[model samples]
Target: MVSTIGRSFNFQPCFLFNSKTVDKSLTARGHSWLWPTAAGVGATAPDRQIRAAAEQRPTWLPGLDPPTYLDGTLAGDYGFDPLGLGEDPESLKWYVQAELVHARFAMLGVLGILVTDLLRVAGISKIPVWFEAGAVKYELANTGTLVIVQLLLMGFAETKRYMDFINPGSQAKDGSFFGLEASLEGLEPGYPGGPLLNPLGLARDIKSAHDWKLKEIKNGRLAMVAILGIFIQASVTHVGPIDNLVEHLSNPWHKTIIQTLASSSS
Candidate 1:
């Protein structure tokens, strides 16, 4: 009876072997009657399943998966790391802080450039152009002394920020510089929260703070692009961005960016 059953069913004693061994044997022998699911009957290991899941995951760019390190926790994260710079966790942390700083500066720079140009055009102030202001000769004596003082102040602040980044929450809050308290306690590493920083209580909670950060990063990115374009336009046309805009509005067909570049090259 046993011999008849074995001969009729083609039973090869699969119970004696492990699942992986059975799978390998069946696959080697061109047999796939074991597993009949969508995952298929061959090579359904945990790593392969993980890889499939990653492939199915979507990113900012369609049909592409985000990098493994960038799991969409940070604000403004769109998986746009083409150069793979943020592969290491430590380096990525530092880079995130640095990018925030640069973005903030770029936002401020765009505002300053636009306001300076607008004030000049409206005859409110006769200040030099934003790019050329450094070369302007001021009437104040010892301008070099003022520059040195400004540098010292800015350097001190930057050093403090850098130290905070390196050793988080290590700076003392009891110290004062020239009657001004140099305290950044009870805040995030980069954000020095106080009335001066958040007078309107815009970021009252964690969720609100995260939303505000997203908004800030988006606007900061736009401002960075705007400032870069402004620099290029100023260098090419030797005019402020506001003036360029006026020219374009005055004559849309002939005063376009391409035409301006062509005329400048000519």
Candidate 2:
């Protein structure tokens, strides 16, 4: 009975997992041996030692199951586990649709602004200068509003995506701002990870979560650059100070250079 109990307590009291040592030393030890430490003397079995160590873990740690390190070694600090978050596919679908709508709206708004600018700049047809300026300003204002909406939508999408990553099982209720009900079964671990208890399955899910983050980073870069460019163009074209500065840039040397070239050609 003592030997059986000692075998159950078989654990290595170390920060790093060393399977060879743990199995050879802790597992092989019986109740006849005892673990002596600052905590106190206890059964040489790994399980009792692990419990003692876990009881000493800092209370400030966040998340559930502060104990249970992936490796056989005891965890000195809290570890990340995406499975802690319960499954909910509806929230994921809402975010996907929200981002899609924002992307489409942003594309249309930018195209409208660009088309208006092209008509004025190309001078393809006679139109009053004031009318063209007004049209451009109007489009700029509308586009700016759309851009702000896109920014907000992107922020929301990013936040939701992050939450989803941290907790794969999360779900949103029907009729939320994100959209109607939808399933996010793909995000769930059972599909990609295979089984809950398998280490290989857990690793796959973790890797997939990281991949999603990478995709978001790329999308964020593109959206930021496009929005920044739009704002810069609007400022350069419409701001009175910038426009006046460009109009007033003059150099007498330009005329002199042209005249000198003309004389030489003659």
Candidate 3:
């Protein structure tokens, strides 16, 4: 699984950012490159499209292309502020080694399992035949994803706290860990004033006990999401007919590969 993540899945940094026609691309660059927040680098074909789109925008930002910013921060920083310079070499290196790799492995393991699973879900592959693991499929996948989900939540919670500690403040009473603050916090503040104040103080005010609990809760939520995705992907991956025609392919996971392709091979 670790090997697959290392060789197959490429982790792409993601920021939950969007834009209208209002401002420069400033903060967008740095919005999501945190440890656990790294989404897949993105689909290769789509990445090319994204790059093409950014190229049409402005080079006001340098090093925003593939060969340079392997993590795609340049595109994130483009049209924005001082530009998403990312971090110093040391930190950047750690981000890749520590965060990116972990995320990559966890996410890919879930994905690989799901890829193998899709065949059975869509009626393309049926039980009472070869490659059918029966109910065991669901059980094993659920068990595996449960671990991933747990680890994911743990990863996110630790990541959030680590970022919080390294950063300078509270996350606000509202509870938007990502900083949407009032708009996104779970428990609303007692009064309207909570909306405008810097959350760092409130974040700092949290006791160590509560903080640990909060971390656990956040991680638990992420674990739930990962489990859900794994479930869906598991079913979806097996919903194909390719598994029946494995003799035509050359890859080790032939059934999975053929099923993933858009069309049949000769």
Best by lDDT: 1
Quality of model 2 by C-alpha lDDT: 0.42
Clashes of 1: 0
Regions of model 2 farther than 4 Å from truth:
1-88, 125-225, 236-266
lDDT (10s digit) by residue, model 3, range 1-266: 01111222235543366534424343356533332322223234675676566456444334333223333332122232232233355454444334333444455554554555465544665443223443355544676787788899989856654554344344443454665556433221111123344344354333333453334334543544675655554355543233333433555564454464444323
Q: Candidate 2, residues 1-266: lDDT per residue as tens digits?
A: 00111222334354355434544355356632333333444444585676565555442232123423222121111222234221234553444334544554555555555555455445664333322444453434686786788899989856755555566545344543345224332334222222332334333454445454335434543554565566654454442222323444554455343453464558
- Point out the higher-scoring one by TM-score: 1 or 3: 1
Q: How do the candidates rank by lDDT, highest first? A: 1, 2, 3
How far out, in Å, is residue 124 in model 1? Answer: 1.9
TM-score of each: 0.76, 0.26, 0.21
- Local accuracy by lDDT, each model: 0.71, 0.42, 0.42
Range of the 10 consecutive residues with the lowest summed lDDT in candidate 3: 1-10
Global fold similarity of model 3 (TM-score)? 0.21
Taking every candidate in turn, the Cα RMSD to the unseen true structure, in Å, is 12.5, 18.3, 20.7
- Who is ahead in TM-score, 2 or 3? 2
